[model samples]
Target: MRTFIFLCLLFEEFHVRFLVLTTMSTISLATEYRDVRASEILKQIENGEDVNLTDCRIIGELNLSEIEVETVPNPKYSELLESGFFDGEDLKRYGVNKDLKVVESNIKIRNSIFENDLDFSNALFNKSLFFVEGNFTSTVNFLCTTFGDFASFIGATFGDSSYFLNTTFKSISLYGIDFEEMWVRWDSLENSLVFDGLTYVKLVRNFRNLEQFEEADAAYYQYRKLRQAEKSWILFQKEWPWISFPKCGDIFMWLTCGYGVKPFRAFGFGGLIVLSFSFFYRGWPAISLRSEEKIDRICRLLPERLQRFIPTIDWPNPGISRLEPNKHTQKVSFWDAFYFSMVTFATIGYGDWYPKDKFRKWVMIEGFLGWLTLGLFLVTLTNVTIRP
Candidate 1:
């Protein structure tokens, strides 16, 4: 009986020990910061200390919204000032009389998990802010927050809606920013989405890596449109003092060129101008319709150089003399006038129909129009062809 009682007691002790170990493991895996406040976070940043919350699960929201960043003097420079490194004359030469002040606020929260909303709106981060592989379960706001130095959100996951309206970054590194469930307020930030230089290239690469071609294309298109509008706005601002000619030029560019984004629009406008000029050319005796005999007589009196400018007229001899209208002296029909206008606009100048009198001015204008639109079309076509 004593032997059996000893065996039962051993089993009971083992079970109790196993239960204690399991309970401790469960506690360790649970959320760490269930009662952490925003004040603690701000204090650390304000003291020029890095805030690292890697692999932590906070119970409540992590809010740092509208936190003011204070600039502090550089320690190295401060010590130099105390040691009198810059004497009176030396200070004047160096152009810095007092201690150099530097600002810094670096945050590193890689692999962290936030259970509730995370707000950093209107918070100024003077230095680096890393959120690599961070996961936010609820809404995350970064509206109007300025990252002065470097900011990275590589492989971050946002479960709910996120806002980055008016957010500014100096050196941002965005790779694998999953927006599948992140409702970023893109409409409000449309104009601000004009990513240029390296940022643009990186954004495209990131989207492509994520297999989101449509998003990348849309971003590229918006980038192009914004660039054109920005150019126009800068020009308009520069010529604001004497606005007459510049205003007219701006209007022309906007209506016909889409401020430079839509080159196909210029083609449509050119077609209308061609038709208008053709109708005008047909109305008044704007072109000279000389007879074949007159053309031959004129060519005979011209030098080689001048003859090249004038076209050759080959009259078909019908073996019998018929009293029909001469080919050269034929009246300009609607189709014939249109053809002439088109060739003139194309700068072909076939010399079959020559502009006469006041029509010469109109021909020159049409030539310029044709050249402008043609150049625009080529540029636009090339851009469309090569665009990613």
Candidate 2:
């Protein structure tokens, strides 16, 4: 009995020890996610100190715009300045802009949460600025911000609107930004982004280098669209149809080939046009076989589903050709409709099939579209494949 009692006490002791250890571990984890005021961090940055925060919740606004820093010469104009082509004063006189402030401290905040708005407009960072896996819960702004050195925001998430209007970066990574809240729009930064040709080009190059083809396409598409609009407005502002000519062409390019960047879109659109017209031909009974010889050829290559719908047609429609059940319309198989649609869309009239009187208009339209789509496909293919 005494031995059993001693065993029970020993078990209780182990249980108590386990509970204590677990409690301590929980406390440690909770501490890691401690709340830090955004003001404190701003103070750290203002004092030119390196910030290394992880797994903390930042409270209040961290407006970096208020920090007073001296304006640094823009390195982009450095070569011109060295060549004596344009001094800083002369550049300013010619309306060339310079940076407002420069932050020369290292910031390596990882896996932290910002609960309020953050602004870094018109500020340049000379050191590495990393916010890996950070979460911004409120509005974030980076208007005209420049990262002169390396910067990375990989795996970061933003809950509210985020802007990068006219922002510049060198050796930066923005590959894995999350916008599950539907707040981050890359095209225009919520309509705040101004059109800058060089900025858009850099963004396209950066996205492509990061292997984000879709993002790169979006950037290029937006750039082209904005540029087209600017030119149209400049050339024929307030003109009704004339002003819309450029936009019409732009829209056509977008629908057919995604502005010559996506070859697959042209291929897919071509296929879709063929498939849709094929259904139209079948449903309307628009096409008719020219002779018994062509019927025999088409039946052997008939699709199985089309074969099932067509009666008295053997599994392969072997040695079968029929005249129109009605004198006005021909009862052609689905294969004939598909074949005619393919030939019409390709503008390849083999003279074996002809559209009836009512179908001639649609046939002409399809032929023209086929010509256009094929040409666009080839052009887009060449554009994407044969890059300079």
Pairs that clash in candidate 1: none
Worst 10 residues of 2 by lDDT: 313-322
Worst 10 residues of 1 by lDDT: 315-324
lDDT of 1 by residue, 289-385 (tens): 4344544454456466854663443323211111225333344445445666787788877665677766688889999988877776777666545
Query: Clash number for model 2?
Result: 0
In model 2, the clashing pairs are none
RMSD per candidate (Å) reads 19.1, 18.6
TM-score of each: 0.40, 0.44
The best candidate by lDDT is 2
TM-score leader: 2
